[model samples]
Target: MRAAVVISPLASAVLAGCVVSQTQGGAEHLAAPDGAVYEGVDTRLLDGELVNFVVAMRGARGPDDVTAYAECAAAQYALIRGYGFARQVRTTVDEKNGAWTGDAVYTISPALPRGTRTIDAEVVVAACRENGIPTV
Candidate 1:
């Protein structure tokens, strides 16, 4: 009976590990080509010439986990930009295991260009002291 119990738990653990491995693998495949993952941003007109934007980050393990790391990076980016811009925004982050995620909503004035206005935004997540910003 004791052996059976041990074997049962071991089997369960192995199954769990397999599930996690599969999930992680799938996430890696879905990861952005540049290795920089990005979630869709929902944009709304808060006022004339003003817009409210919601950015979300998702990953494997769990959407919440992916969000957590993303939020931290986002906050740092916002702070580097300026408080004026950061204050006009709200952020949410979630994480699970090795996965990370983040979400934010904010308002911007003066409006951007008609098309997509890509700004230079990058964050350092490790201590390797390497830059991940892509040159446009």
Candidate 2:
């Protein structure tokens, strides 16, 4: 009976972890993909095909985590807006108040933007999935 009880709690813990979603944490100011908390933003509306979304996350996150999360959001946003690609304009990652934040500008277009850091819709989506990163 004791063994059975121990096994029951262990199974519950494992199941609990499995149930956590990709976009579960949003305790920050602006939410991002994965458990990255949204810190804040400075997004703007430029033209119909060009948009910039500056986002942040609250945590002891690294530059890679913040950038990847921002890219994931940008890529997903493009897809949601009926665009197939996003051209990365600039990315600024900083640490503030012990929180890691990233500011990125992406140009949404029906086709890939003319940039080396441009993100392809299908490619980014697949990368996010494979890496367990969440998308907007």
Best by lDDT: 2
Off by over 4 Å in 1: 1-34, 58-87, 96-101, 111-136
Summarize candidate 2's per-residue lDDT along 6-91 as a digit string, tens digits. 11111122334432223322112122234556555555667877666666676534565676666777778888888888766776
* Prediction 1 global C-alpha lDDT: 0.31
Per-residue alpha-carbon lDDT of candidate 1 for residues 59-99, written as tens digits (9 for 90 to 100): 34444333323333433343344421222244455555533
Q: What's the lDDT for residue 90 in model 2?
A: 72
TM-score of 2: 0.63
Poorly placed runs, candidate 2 (over 4 Å):
1-43
Best by TM-score: 2
